[model samples]
Target chain A: METEGIYDVQAIRAQFPILSRKVKGKDLVYLDNAATAQKPLSVIDALVHYYSHYNANIHRGLHTLADEATAAYEASRVAVKEFVGASSPDEIIFTKGTTDSINLVAYSWGKSFLQEGDEIIISSLEHHANIVPWQMIAAEKKAILRVIPISDDGILDMEAFKSMLGPKTKFVSVVHVSNALGIINPVEEIIRLAHQHNAVVLIDGAQSSVHLDIDVQTLGCDFYAFSGHKIYGPTGVGVLYGRRDLLESMPPYQGGGEMIKEVRFEYTTYNELPFKFEAGTPNIADVIALKAGIDFIKSIGKHAIRKHEEQLLEYATAKLKDIAGLRIIGDVKNKVSVISFVIDGVHPQDLAILLDNQGIAVRTGHHCTQPLMHRLGIVGTTRASFAAYNTLDEVELLIQALNKSLKMLL
Target chain B: MNNHRTIKNIEQELIDDFSLFETWEEKYEYLIDLGKKLAPLDPAFKTEEYKIKGCQSSVWIHSFAKDGFVYFEGDSDAIIVRGLVGLMITVMNGQPAKEIVEAPLEFINTIGLSSHLAQTRSNGLRAMIKQMKMDAGAWQVNAENKTVE
Candidate 1:
């Protein structure tokens, strides 16, 4: 439990009640953390507390419940701002999830500023959520979409990315950590390079926000996006952190009750920063509960969590490497606790089914990175992503299950 | 009753075969074994033209009609899905076009496959069945045209 300095994974695992559940007569070994992490009891309690105690619409009435809900929701904004080291809470806009956040930028910023022959740069390591929005905007505006290729080992081609950046490059979006490959991209360097070309950078932090420590000012990124569920928070809530200046300059993403200052038959004025992007009533309960998740991470400390996950990744990598015919994808020097692999002559789906029967949950498919899979010349890979709660023993169980399943398949 | 007896007999055989396994694990192993024994499809027929949509995994199904009987050959990138395809082909292939179209495939439920498979896999299975039925209908029309000629 206490392997390293001040970190006890057993204590962390105890906070998450779902870790104790059994599936199919076997103890559940949840390894699908990248898809969405299991909620901690504290986060769940926060959700229940909100609905039971203060179930009212946010930013509306002068009633006590409404006031309580509004305060909690705004507190959550401050928590998120501190979590990612944003300059102010006003910079954090709550949306549905990471996909919704990216779509907001693509429509609001891209539609208003981008023009014909303008270029938007994204890496090959991006999930479809990060890719499709840019593609849609590019198609509409006739802006060219350029991709920074990745090496066979899943590291981005930095030289190619630098060459791709030019005066025409208006925007650059890259994944901070690949969901499928677990490769931690050098986003700071990417932002610096993109800035040299006078291009704004958006770091897709869907995978990194939970695993790594993020300081947006230090990174100097124009925008950062991540989902709450990827951390220990509830779904239907995410944060889109944009520079205050950029957000103010951009038009409103959606026109609704919360996003408008005033509306008339002749004209309409949008709300201030953050509210300009958040159109509707928003996922109030989930957003309020997200503070608990942020608090949960802060209490555990990001350094400790990162250390634990790094150990898991190293141990799993070594164990999986010993298996015959099993090839680990994306063996980069810097990565989170995610392992994607494929076995010769065994389809990833079949392997996933066998693992599920043994009560080990993993994701198998393109992982919404179909272009990445195509680039790697693989149909798909079975991905086992770990959270702070996952133990080395669980990794052992995974190894044993893979061995048994491989023997059966062979 | 004899008009569709072959399809019914094959479905019953599948149900009995699946019933041999006491646990889902053993059943899945059996399915994987069956998938390995699936008749290989022609490389040329593995194109996007023959690929079945609505499947999580890439699945290609090819069929042809000869002497009023429709034969199907199917393959999937996922082994478990391929096994499901093999099970379907075992029951419906080499049957009359009318029988292939009309057979309800009640054996999927009878064998407890419908309950066992995940929602996406179940949808994929239904898509395969629908595509096979469409292929049979098209082939039946072509056969009718030949008779007219």
Candidate 2:
């Protein structure tokens, strides 16, 4: 990936088939990137290629197609390992998506390590995927759940986090980037501090992995999880990276074929590092296409993509702040590409509808982070998230749509 | 607005009559007609300042108290939004403050609107209603304060 500002927005836009169409008679200006990114032709073609050429189950069979399938499947793990700068390919385990990955950790790690009266610390910035699983496990395990508070700027208080990390703290899970606020948390420092207290840390990288350069090994976090769809890959496939020793210490999340080493009548042995975790038949086609997504990101260059996104964020933030009665939420100093705001008199749902009629797509609601909504004293927000492919022209279209809606409503 | 129950009863009565329509298409036509019978909102009342945040369509709702009852008038840029406002106003407007506050909103299920709406839209509707109720509660408290004075 070159850092020489090779961001051809028009060329990038052409790669996504969905971008050419019209929604409600206007050109589709999709600003809902944080919800799910539009896939490029490379990722789509990879899916078609897998189904058309070698569509067979991986790792178990001896035939030619099986060998091809196994090679592609294993290659994705290698790609993900390299993408996140993991220590080994063995650390990358495949699952349905980020939600499933976090749930697996909660059940396997929380169930195994968290005892009665233990503590699990999370911050107010978590998506429900990171919160509810821990809540359910905490309830079942009789462990006390603690929450690190956040300031009005949507930044987590490290002092509060340090205070929360006592001897009773067994685990700490935090979002690397807040889905609702666009706040880029100092996860490396959080992980380092948590390690000082001997507590395992899990960083939810669903939003961060796409825009940020992640080196999980250097971060020293125990576990990291992310989804492929958010990174321009197909949905329903995700990666979970854990320390080799920690993964070996935990139990398997599910029981099924391919995960067993040897199943005897009396006893059963689990399979290797990743296979031990991927129990059933994986999302075969999607896992293969995920490698293509990684290739796309690498070809474009993470540094260049990050710079493009930062420019979009700055431009959109300035424009949106100009709208009357529109108060932007989570004014954190460090952020990714998400912008959440609320109009005083206009319901976000209404705003979304009006925007949709003009073929502008934006996410409106609590964004699956209801507890954060309560903390912010809002029912929901109108969220416009950017991607590498988004251009200044598209941002102008969004603003125009918003202006028209406000005029019609007011 | 001491006549919310009466309005609800009228809506139920209308639905009962429309239920006789043989097909869903016909039933839907009749239901929409029933919605048209509710009082029309004024054009001036339609403003961004009154737009309810969180709906897919642009909707503006404002209320004015007349004879101790809050009379709500709302307009929307979309037809479905207008219909939703009509449904809510049927159960909310023209009711005694106490009754309006305590009224069971379970009838929303019978109307099939709650189930038909997506979860996000449903939540927005709930928030709008909650805001209306809070306004009504404030009025009720003011009434008590005036009596005590």
Candidate 3:
């Protein structure tokens, strides 16, 4: 796999066909990594391999095809467990995506532990996926939901967060990395603080899971949820890693065939551990493909990738900050590869349109974190997020495009 | 223009209004002016209750049924959003449920709003129009039921 320049940035670009296609008759500069990372050939090939060769439902059959599929599926789970440094594969349950995984915890955990006046703590930097489900659950259970405020730098205001934690705080679900601001909260500290109050913690790892190495045991988070798509894996597959005891204590999310051990009209028994939560047929191809994504990440090595990304962020920030009327939002020092900014004169939408005309793809909006958007006192911002595949040349092109777009708009 | 006065000639009038411009520039100019003619949104109407969810801009949409037609008043904190609402109301307002429901959305293409809008905003418009159409359909059904009674 480490053939001379085989994984070289330019060589890697050749594998993804989407990158080759011209947008507005110019080379595509996909700067929307926080939204979804572009899939590599290995991940794409894994999906094709699964569908083309071993396309069968797992766990229920003893036939050769079923056996092959089941092995592949379980292998992926083991990979995920290793990838996230979870203790057991039994702790990993697959779902639709990060939103679904968070919903699972909100409904199941909230139902089991929460009651009238019980408090759940979240941060100001949470995505709507992390925010709304908790809100719904809190509404249903008559629980008080508290928000931990953020500093102007976009990192979690740790002092405020510490103050917010108390005995009534049943659980704290917070974003490990904010999708909008790209700020990585100190989750280990958050989990520790929450635990001091006897509160369980769930980390919405949608953004961080891709960029950072995670160890649930070390972090001591009760549950962790992230989507595969954000990690260059296929969409429609996500993983929720809950401590075995907590997972066992909670009720199943959805009722379906695979989740049940035995089902009669009068009574039904859920299967043990992971399958009990993974209702219905899972996204088999995507789940299998996720292993390839994990492998790809491992092959590149997290340290090298993180170092590369930090350089990109530094370069992009310096260049963008230099541009007149460009105010970079969420200028926290501890951000991942995302940069959210608002131009003084041009609307983010208008800037985005002009950028699109130049074949530069960047996210412009509240980024599904409307409450956070409100807190920031802006309707939206233009976000340019980076990934390992993105090169310095692309960054130069982006700045050039911004210059041209500014000339056109301002 | 005289025939445009009658209810039977409404479609013809709309077509004629649409045909007034051979070029897109003239059509956009007409649409923008139409927006200008819209009575300014009451400042009080910008309350949180009137705000549409899932939009990047702060948009307030207020609708009421009058003379069996749904009339909408909208404003937004963002200029482009107001411009979008102006375009929406121009195509949609005054037309009864059946005609409005069946109106070709192709005018969005003609005005180039679809091409110009961000993907999320474009989807947001679809969601808003869907909600409006569904409400209108339900209203028409209720009216028909009342007539039968």
Q: DockQ winner among the candidates?
A: 1
Query: Every prediction's TM-score for the first chain?
Result: 0.98, 0.99, 0.97
How big an interface RMSD has model 1?
A: 1.7
Question: For candidate 1, lDDT tens digit of each residue in B1-149?
Answer: 34555988888888888888798867877778788899889999999999986435878999988878999999987788888888888888888898888888888887765753635552378888889999998998899899999
| Tens digit per residue, CA lDDT, model 1, A1-410 | 22346677888889999989998789999999999999999999999999899999989789999999999999999999999999999999999899999999999999899999999999999999999999999999999999999999999999999888898999999999999999999999999999999999999999999999899999999999999999899999999999999999999887888989999999999889888888888899999999999999888787788888888899999999999998999987899989999889988877877888899999988898999999999988999999889999999999999999888788
Where is model 1 more than 4 Å wrong at Cα?
A: A1-6, B1-4, B54-56, B115-118, B121-123, B142-149
**Each prediction's interface RMSD?**
1.7, 7.6, 4.2
Predicted complexes: DockQ each? 0.61, 0.09, 0.19
Model 1's chain B yields a TM-score of 0.90
Which of 2 and 3 is the better model by DockQ?
3
Compose the digit string of candidate 3's lDDT tens values, residues B27-129. Answer: 4445445544556799888787777664555667776666677767887544445556776766567657666666656555443446656345533566556
> What docking tier does model 2 reach?
incorrect
Whole-model lDDT values for every prediction? 0.90, 0.83, 0.82
Better of 1 and 2 by TM-score: 1
Clashing pairs in 3: none
How does residue A279 of candidate 1 score in lDDT? 84
Candidate 1's docking class is medium
lDDT of 3 by residue, A135-168 (tens): 9999999999899987676767899888887879
lDDT of 2 by residue, A44-95 (tens): 9999999999999999899999999999999999999999999899999998
Clashing pairs in 1: none
